[model samples]
Target: MLTLACSWLGMQWVHEAGHVLGALATGGEVERVVLHPLSISRTDLRTNPRPLVVTWAGPAFGVLAPLILWGMARGFSLDSAYLFRFFAGFCCLANGAYIGLGSFDAVGDCGELLRNGAAMGELWLFGALSSASGLILWNGQGRHFGLGNNGQPVPFRHCAGLAAITVGLISAGNLFFGTG
Candidate 1:
């Protein structure tokens, strides 16, 4: 149980890091990165009129990190190594979705400068990336909706309960059903 908890925490760290690094690389300034068991809170620069490429980079990196880590872990393929990779992948996807979807708020706020009329390539890209991440999290943990784009404070108990239930189910399935 402890091992699983630690693994989940580690994965969450990596996931949040992915978002931070992506934002930094793309010239998006980070306001805060609040680490928690349930969610990672990040408030990035919304004032700048950044290029679509720059805006897209943060979430792109977030999605890519776990995939790369998972591939590396799979290469090792030792005892239960893949599970670690999966956890990391799930974290990356979830956090990536948050960053990607959350970018909309910024874009919407600076609509006059960044909107670019009807050309919505950046919007579509971010939305798609976030949606993909949400789907991955849903499949792995049965967590469907996150705190909305507003970044509301979700009760820690609720988030912890969901995570606990997910871990329990995964463990039980592995033990009784002999499936990993």
Candidate 2:
């Protein structure tokens, strides 16, 4: 349970860090990243077309972070494999849940994509990408860590509960922090 929560928080940080990296890559100034209740970035930039890229970058990096971590962890000792696996799996699940659960109503990368006229298929594509990546990472990592086959599948109710927790945390953060 501790590992699960830590993995979730790590993925959130990586997701938000993706935004910061995108801002820097696109010539925007990043003020800070808040990681208390949720991960949000404060940036200084002008309104322009780059916001779309910046938004997309979050999930992009979110998906990429675990992959990179997993790849890098390959050269290390096996004892630390669980750490990489947990983080990678969390990243995939976090991004996947954010999209697959329709939690990105009007504020996330998907919302930005929709506002910019992205087709529903494109949004579904994003969800598919994250879901597949997450499943692959989770299953693969489980195998690598000898967690055995025939693991118990997470039921829809559990997924819904997890989604609710995520949404609640973000909502609380936004309410208290003003979504800056």
Candidate 3:
């Protein structure tokens, strides 16, 4: 489950990074960012000029950043490109599901989206497109995780090392971002 852990943490970080970028783009001041491993991630803005853009940025960039990274990995012919691809797919699925599914429950960012003029149909469309893209990207990815011999295998040690490093970086970064 090391890989899953890393992917989860990385996804949260990237999603929040998107919000940070949006805030920066809109001249919003980030008052605090909560990204603890054990807590739900959120970005609190002190001065948000454009709430809709900031809210949308969280998931939009969350999915795009990893896709870009995966593209770069594939372009460079990295043997670990599958891992990056998997991460990208996972982000799309998670973020899409979070927003799409959240529409039904009317909570979290989706709630905020709706409150700020986002149509449920728009949320559904985003969810469907992103999750479908994730699934399409994940096709034929089984072999990378020691599944059928259809692709290059990723070593367990590398995954473990990645997990460790990810935890370290996120934990350290939180010191600067937590509750401020």
Candidate 4:
């Protein structure tokens, strides 16, 4: 459990760090990188027209650490391998969900940049998907876990709903394909 927790945390760090690196690469200055117990945020210069690129960079950046860890996990014992794979899969899914959801802000931010003569189509799509999925999840979850947002204790019903969905997906997958 400790290993799983550590792996989760490590993956999150790498994912968030990717956003920071992307911001820097695209001529945007990172204002602050805040690491809290439950989450991290890389606040950057809002004035930069390349916010979409920076936002897209975050999820892309996050994939690196998990892939590296997945490679390392392959050489481990069976039990450890299972744990590592689970961790890797969870990280990938969670990060993908996050990127897809959080990028909604990119549309508005990118629009502003576009007005200033910066054009980016791919970034726009990434941002739109992220934002749309994020909004849907937020609505369903009954809370907002978004950039600059703080953690809140989720309601029990909400937790249960999420668990049921996860279990249902796993059960359906196993029943149909004999695999998770």
Candidate 5:
């Protein structure tokens, strides 16, 4: 549950950041971005000439940021690198489902993309690829979660501490920086 909470907030921030970046890249204006913890994240544009690009950026960057972070962690030979991979996979799965399943109702970013000339087939393809990637990343991660045998006992206390820290930091960030 702690990881889920952190992942939720992280996804919202990264996805919104992607929208902001896309808007700025296209010479558009971003009017407001809502990042409330209790609400779904969104970036409202004042002027958008490339809505499709902006819309695509949300999920694209959401998945990419975590993967990049995981890659860097692995490059450093970090012990907790699997956590980063899990986070990346979580982001991908969340974003993919948000785009794929939500397409049925033409909701959220999916709706925006479609309205801006995105083909349904393209959206489904992205969904399939992203979801598959996320699952692949998650494969063989059962040991970390204490489901598999690694010849040693899992550190429950350490995991709990990490979860606590994640919740605290994420909640604090949302309470502070997300208020606007």
Candidate 6:
């Protein structure tokens, strides 16, 4: 449980950091980033008016970060490469699961897309893409559905735990904050 909570915390950082990076990259100035159990928040101070692109950036970064790490790990020596590989798979699973689950409600990254006038098809497609990519990466790690030779599928529990905690907390946040 502690591991799951810590990992949940770390993934939230990565998720929000993605938003900060996206805002910065898109020529927006990010004032601050805050991570709560319910959601990762970013204050973009840029008045430049690039809302759609900036909004998409956070989830894009979440999906891409692990893939980037995995790709870069290919260049490392054999022994050291495993660490990056583990993290890559972990990030992919965590982020993908988080997005897939969170999208079921009228809030979160997917909600941001819809509120910005994105079609339902677009939302579903993005969810499928991210989740599929994560599954593919997980397959490579031999841990899909806990069928790996090592018999340790508990890692997926972390993914599910993230999703559960996110949904519960975000729902609570919405109740308290009134779904701005």
Which number leads on lDDT?
Answer: 3
The candidate 1 region of ten consecutive residues with least summed lDDT is: 140-149
Regions more than 4 Å wrong, model 2: 38-49, 140-180
Give lDDT per model, in order.
0.49, 0.65, 0.88, 0.50, 0.84, 0.60
**What lDDT tens digits, residue by residue, belong to model 4 across residues 1-180?**
333345455554566577677777877776655443344433445445476566555666565566566668676643334334444555565565554443355333344345445445544554455444434433422222222355444445544644554455445434532321
TM-score for each of the candidates: 0.45, 0.68, 0.92, 0.48, 0.87, 0.63
Choose the strongest candidate by TM-score.
3
Residue 64 alpha-carbon offset, candidate 4, angstroms: 3.5
Query: What is the number of backbone collisions in each predicted candidate, taken in the order shown?
Result: 0, 0, 0, 5, 0, 0
RMSD over all Cα atoms, model 4: 15.2
Report the error of model 5 at residue 148, Å: 2.5
Rate residue 161 of model 6 by lDDT.
58
In model 2, the worst 10-residue window by lDDT is 39-48
Cα lDDT tens digits, model 1, 136-157, are 6445332222334443343465
- Tens digit of lDDT per residue, candidate 6, span 65-86? 7567667767665433433455
* Off by more than 4 A, model 5: 151-180
Model 3 has how many clashing residue pairs? Answer: 0
After aligning candidate 4 to the native by TM-score, how far in Å is the CA of 127 from where it should be? 12
Clash number for model 2? 0
For model 5, state the Cα shift of residue 97 in Å.
0.8
RMSD after CA superposition, every candidate: 13.4, 7.9, 1.8, 15.2, 2.5, 7.6
Clashing pairs in 4: 15-62, 100-130, 101-130, 101-134, 104-131
Question: Positional deviation of 56 in candidate 1, in angstroms?
Answer: 3.1
Question: How much does candidate 5 score in TM-score?
Answer: 0.87
